[model samples]
Target: MGRAPSDSAGGDRLRFLRSFLASPRKVGAVLPTSRRTVDNTLDLAPLEEARWVVELGAGTGVYTRGILERVGSDARVVAFEVDAQLSSILASQLRDPRLSVVSDSAVNVARHLDGAAVDVIVSAVPFTSLPVPERKQILRAARDALGREGIMLVLQYSPLIERELRQTFTYVRRRLSPLNVPPAFLFACQGDPRSPAGER
Candidate 1:
């Protein structure tokens, strides 16, 4: 069988640019997540034994593939992409029984999770570019969706949201990847133990 309409590499990049132009804040970058960014982000998450992994803003499946590669065969990956076009392409390109590509706002991620506690969440969402309220909302949802021992890895071009992440997660650590387009900051967060698993 041939690759789907959204499966072409050149076409994917062109569509990514159009999506970025349509919603700069949401798309965040003109190009997809770089290898260095993805590597640094996933390194913070314990993906080897992760049974449930959630990927936010999985633009072109860069981090999605990284997570999948490191996770066990029984692992389940829930990828949230607000852009329908990009989400469609992801659904086409990543056809694994373990993956679920949801076309929805990242703030509403918990709604699609069915009360499952996530083991790791690799977020490529642009926290710096989004409005403060949306940023808080999405972070809150992610916090609630995590298990007590869950880990969240957020990748951004700036450290603007480090304080915000600290507010949600009990233990927050930051790392920098200098090889990306504009370089990037990765925040590794461990959820507060007081919250119940999958409460959101």
Candidate 2:
């Protein structure tokens, strides 16, 4: 396969704009995560003991690949791809036995694994244009899945969603990834305060 285009996420978003506009509501599948950005997010992970990695809107396995590269070989990754075509592609391409590609709604993150607490929930969903209710629900589910000591990392193109996370999580962090399309922001927050791993 040819190398994916690597253009500055600034004004020339290239593949990001094309992929993001592929669907209605001005939103599409997840934007491909850049390697540098992925490593940065992985560095933000609090617990070394985490076994479950839940990926929301894995899209084409961009961040999924990034997470896999950082986590242990036995770490379980539950990838939720809301797009059928993308899900099918991910299921076949990822060779790791630890990867489970689920073709389902991202809002059902908790239900898919029987309400189990995940160590980390990395979301690549675009929330700026979504209905407020749907946005709130997704954030709530992400918070719930953490159980205790669980964290949710959201990669967004705008600051609007960061406001939502601030109200819900114990503490919220905003990191700029200069490597991605549009130089996205990485919002990391603890779902619940009491269970924070004390790593902030």
Candidate 3:
């Protein structure tokens, strides 16, 4: 018999805690993201019309599942998770052909894209915890990976990434999701004029 929904949820929490304990900086949060925060983050992304979507730091498949629900049947989602165990669990649980769980760092996102233009990029990455050079590298990769009309949606516990987003994208919009655990900031960014693909 299949596991009960509550059991599955419990397992996810346990796994998330273990991952966080193993790598506090990479996992960022002790608990998985709240559903409200996931909704707030996705609300700004153009997922319904997106052909290719990239999710950075897809912990426990919370936002990954949300992305699958919102995108069309033909859409593709590439979810990056730095933790090997989390990546493995997410891939096995979802088992959706539309989703690809990449066991790699977000900085290597561009390499996995195979040059396909991404329509929307959703990030749960803990930029504040990363080294400056690494953060900038990932941001640059994300910017260059997007198509002309692409948008990048970021959910962060702090607004520390706002300046970086503004510098990378010509248009950056911020919203607050206060109902989330610890409250969170959402950034919807587009219009990277410097992108080789042109303005977005």
lDDT of 2 at 60: 68
Off-target runs (Cα >4 Å) in candidate 2 are 1-19, 24-31, 46-48, 193-200
Worst 10 residues of 1 by lDDT: 1-10
Clashing pairs in model 1, backbone N/Cα/C closer than 3 A: none
What would the per-residue lDDT of candidate 3 be over residues 1-200, giving only the tens digit for each residue? 12112217788999999999998987888888888898899999778899999999998988887888888888889999989989998888888778899999999998899999999999999998988998899998998898888999998899988998998898999999999888999999998867565456
Structural similarity to truth (TM-score) of each candidate:
0.90, 0.82, 0.93
Clashes of each: 0, 1, 1
- Among all candidates shown, the one with the greatest lDDT: 3
**TM-score of structure candidate 3:** 0.93
Q: Better model by TM-score, 2 or 3?
A: 3
lDDT of 3 at 130: 85
Q: lDDT for each of the candidates?
A: 0.85, 0.73, 0.88
Q: Once model 2 is optimally superposed onto the true structure by TM-score, how far is the C-alpha of residue 155 displaced, in angstroms?
A: 0.5
* Model 3 ranges with Cα > 4 A deviation: 1-7, 195-198
Q: Sort the candidates on lDDT, descending order.
A: 3, 1, 2
**104 Cα displacement, candidate 1 (Å):** 0.7
Candidates sorted by TM-score, best first: 3, 1, 2
In model 2, the number of clashes is 1
Which regions in candidate 1 have their CA more than 4 angstroms from the true location?
1-9, 193-200
